[model samples]
Target: MTKQLPYSDAELAELIRNGDAEAFRSLFERFIRALVYFGVKLTGDQEESEDAASEAFQKLWQKREDMRGYPEMRAYLFSIVHNRSVNFVKRRSMVKAAHQTIQAEGETHSDSSITTRIIQAETMVAIHNAIDKLPLHHRDLLHKIYIEEQSTTDLAKMLGTTPAHIRTSKARALASLREILSDETLLRSCIVFFFLFSAK
Candidate 1:
């Protein structure tokens, strides 16, 4: 059996800073999957979560020395993950919200002749499609507040802003999404993806 390596976060940080590849590998093994799961939970997108977690780990490796004296290694790692996930979600929200708004408007008819069920179905699709296009910040806000059902106070605290600020940000983000997606029309059957390139 391979010898077990017992290391503290500070020691591991030192090892990484000293350019110990084995230490880095150990650290990656310990945290990568957990970070990815956390990212997915926060962002509600598996691929984006994976990308964020991977990118965050890459960044940590690049700046290993900075991890020293962090008091809480897990917290520090999760912080990076949170920031990256938030940014990704916001960007997506902006783009997707816009697209959804336009699509929904296009499908809505003035005549009350259309079945309510059909309208709801089409509107839901438009909503999801637009959400898919939103900017990372906006998308992140929506997911945290609405999808994840986080309390405004908790979100504000996590974001380092006040509850009022969070509310304002959400409003502005929504407005921005509406403005962008109000008119842009793509083929109804086609899907637009912003995830073509992963963040390195």
Candidate 2:
């Protein structure tokens, strides 16, 4: 049987639109459990689902005037939580499947911070391979500048070249490395992966 919107629900919905806090509280108390259950069924994690439900209620408060009656209000809340759950799933999938694109090898670690986690071993290997593919002169230039931390002037003095030439070579080497490292899917996954962990 369909869940009918009671007259009391409709009355409270209108009251909330008029900025009545008591009525809003009544409505929240009435529907929060069902909303959380709805979210949990979709996300499979109670905490995340409840968080989504909370966000939905916050949105519904802001958008109270947009929806009318109990049915629209209930649907609106469910819609917001459902979209949140689906978008999160999509983001997780993108990162988790990063290796499928590179024909190579990767996590859901909550501590995946840049300051703490730094770069992964596989990412470092991929970067080293990309650098190795550069022209020998470009590779040596990158190594001296980045790995050895040589200033342009220092590099120039060692290589019997002007600092201006070393600067130009550094720019070219970085550009070449970027081209070699251009794996679109992997790059997208890394971005999503980083943000995902940071949110936790």
TM-score of each: 0.43, 0.45
Residue 166 in candidate 1, Cα distance off native in Å: 52
Q: For residues 1-200, what per-residue lDDT tens digits would candidate 1 score against the true structure?
A: 12222333455556567767776666665566667766675578989878887877787777766665424555566667677766776767667777554432222223342234233433554455567678898989988988899999999889899999999989987887676465323412121111111111
Backbone collision tally, model 1 = 28
Q: Which sections of candidate 1 miss by over 4 Å?
A: 1-7, 70-73, 99-200
Q: Candidate 2's residue-wise lDDT over 2-22, tens digit each?
A: 223234445656777877676
Report clashes for each candidate as comma-separated counts. Answer: 28, 0
Position 66, candidate 1: lDDT: 66
Model 1 worst lDDT run, 10 consecutive residues: 191-200
Q: lDDT per model, in order?
A: 0.62, 0.66
How far residue 146's Cα lies from its native spot in candidate 2, in Å, is: 64
User: For model 1, what is the error of residue 105's alpha carbon versus the real structure, in angstroms, after optimal superposition?
Assistant: 23
